[model samples]
Target: MYPRLFTAAAFCLIAVASSKAEEDSHAIFRRAEAPKEVRAAVTCDEADDIITRDAFAGGWLWQSKCPSNHANFIKAQIFSRDKNGKDAKLIRFPVPRGTPLEEISNVEFFPATREFNSLFVNPEDESVCRTEARWIAQNALKPKLVFWRETKDCDGKKGWRVLKGRK
Candidate 1:
């Protein structure tokens, strides 16, 4: 009787431990099965140029306009694969402020010049400022403005519109 009782207790403990382990494994698998979001703002065709496998290389260029300034510009170049398989983009301008805020009045893309130009109007006062032509490398994901400068005439902060690549 005593031996039978001991064996039953041991079996019960083993069964409980096995059940806990299975539950833990299921939890871990569930977490691992979740999907991840990819960060690609523009399609391949939207890029300035797309290179096939072994054609040239995978990379991209990004550009952003400065606030209130017509001539100043920011640009960056991003590579598809790093030396160690790490994908990264190099930022040319290191502005603390992210992207300028302006209501884009007009946008123009010059194929000959390979430049993107636009005119932005302040959302608050409607003050107009021209964004000079700037060239961005092809393949960049989403180039965000990191810094900005305010024009003497347009000193107020307002929203900005992106006019690049707009038809």
Candidate 2:
């Protein structure tokens, strides 16, 4: 009788521990809805469906997006906030018109170098274009575009042509 009671108690403790562990796995970051000014500027009536948010160089970067006609495409925008966390400003990526924010655009920021990168790839032909920028200073409003390139032709032989700086 004593041995059976001990076993039951041990099983209940194990079950409770596992349940708590599972609950903690699904972590969430609770942030207020984007400000009215931000929503108006981005033209997103509804609240931001945040894809990613990060803090860098005394400011915050928020990547909000909505789904498009295609599963792989999205209507995305990246907004930045100053050190005081006021006035969200859009970081523009100079891509051609009618181009949706597709998954091929791997937008990422490197903390070590304070550089940001975005790729615009054509799904039809797999041709790629990219933009690279670096934040000049901690109080800088925007990043300086260090490099940008575009691929105009679908032909595989036609390689990427530099847009601004010589590379």
User: Whose lDDT is greatest here?
Assistant: 2
TM-score against truth, every candidate: 0.24, 0.50
Alpha-carbon lDDT, every model: 0.32, 0.48
Count clashing residue pairs in model 1: 13
Could you tell me which residue pairs clash in candidate 2?
A: none
Model 1, runs deviating above 4 Å: 1-96, 100-105, 123-133, 138-167
lDDT (tens digit, per residue) of candidate 2 on 28-116: 23234555444444544333354344555545555555433231233344445542235766555433334422222345666446566
RMSD after CA superposition, every candidate: 18.3, 8.6
Instruction: Note the clash tally of each candidate.
Output: 13, 0
lDDT assessment of candidate 2:
0.48
